[model samples]
Target: MSVTKTSPTTNTDASLLADHEVESTYRSVNNVQLHIVTAGDPDAPLVILLHGHPDFWYGWRDQISPLVEAGFRVVVPDQRGCNLSEAPDGVDAYRLSELSADVCELIHSEGQESAHVIGHDFGGFVAWNVALRQPSIVDRLGILNVPHPTVYRDTLKSSPQQIARSWYVWFYQVPKLPEWMLRRNGMDNMVASLEVTSNSGTFDEETIERYRAAWQHTGVHPRINWYRGFRRSGSPSRNTVTQPTLICWGTEDIALLPSMAEKSVDYCENGQLRMFPNASHWVHHEREEVTEELLRHLSQNSLS
Candidate 1:
């Protein structure tokens, strides 16, 4: 494992977890080196934040301070194949089982038996798998703007609306074209997609630039590999979630339907769903209300 300090590039970069004191390091976990940003006391209850597609640890910037101040150690990682994290070649390397193992190993790396796990978008999918595959390592599960794996699969097959919205996933199946298109014109198309899919003012110029920097460092192929890998990963063997779960969703998500949220709860033994009518797929970016809700969920039913 290699550890080093992160040099700040902009004012926003400098302010990341500024009040709580931030530590950036690279740890070899699950056969890949992951770049992780951590804050709050090392002894506090752990809470891991997983970011989604085309996003890095910075995606959880808005909620990090709040979680830290509330007496929780927050660990946000640039999952393998994104940002400064090591990206292993091949779509199979990015499979759901492999991604889930990274999280499980990450918890052990922190010297923790279990931790509250929360994720958004693709991260949410990873979180769900982690809870399902290794329930004992997850104290609580929180998913933002993503449905259960089975729900997502069933929706994609049964609902034309979902299939239509997910046209990009099919487009990504092509070998090199999707990567070329995403990288064209200084990543203008990729930047535009973020702005268009999210609610107005969700991603400002500075934020977009921050993402652009990470995208340039990681390249587009590994990120696109997530979609490609999922296509070949096959259906999940275990769908039931025994751990306490919270699903926070933005109803206006262009890619996933709101009905999936209600359906997702069905698979959980004890699960609750909160819908943000006006928020888009980037519900975690909404910050205030979602953060409060997350804190409440994590605080309840202490597993420690």
Candidate 2:
């Protein structure tokens, strides 16, 4: 990633009917029609959720039901180039700045003036920009297992171990091979990784199939484009994250450690940290109950 201090963040949530998420669609920063899975009352306070790389809104499955029950209107989008979301053909459309706009449009389209935003992994990355770019549109923020962009850059520079953990990112920088590997060995590896890496094993054959089906789409280039955008994106560095925020880290995450997570509060004017000592990268899934608690705490910060 290039080094810089600037950028911003999309939305609706559509889910499979088995769980009864409402079917909806929204346009992204790129103006592509995208589907979203949403639950809760539109009239209630809004909480829009986002998922990260190699994942979709399903990543928030455990928390969604609980959060909705807790009385927050939750919106979880597939995000640009993921699952039901639009995948613009060219890589240029997948840049971070553009990705940030997707978030903005979703909020603009929501008709609500503001929302509590939550994101995991890449979603967390986008969450930062969304909250930053449109502070008035966001009420609060919750981020799981993703450091601020700049802190992540420091990890790559200062720690060889962190670099090693991020080897997949290097592989993803390639043109087509990463997708090919994922299409083959990558899926099973991801499933296996989920079983051991998270505090609880949420991955099963059925879940993997859903993910696979999403990946089997024609516009996978945009998915790879996110990694490609990293090269063009400014070098990740720590900067002010002004949103009232909560950062959650899975302690056992092979790719990240507590030290990097600790750096988040430096930029955050108002921030809190929650760590899952036994959970890996998928901290929310590993410690579902605790994740729900933090999400509730952050989302309800402005409640009447």
Q: Largest lDDT belongs to which candidate?
A: 1
Question: Runs in model 1 with CA error above 4 Å?
Answer: 1-17
Error of 1 at 253 (Å): 0.6
- Per-residue CA lDDT of candidate 1, range 144-212, in tens? 999999999999989999999999999999999999999899899889889878999999997898888
Which residue pairs collide, candidate 1? none
Worst 10 residues of 1 by lDDT: 1-10
Each candidate: what lDDT?
0.87, 0.71
Candidate 1 overall lDDT versus native = 0.87
lDDT of model 2 at position 230? 61
Which consecutive 10 residues in model 2 have the weakest lDDT in total? 1-10
lDDT of 2 at 15: 41
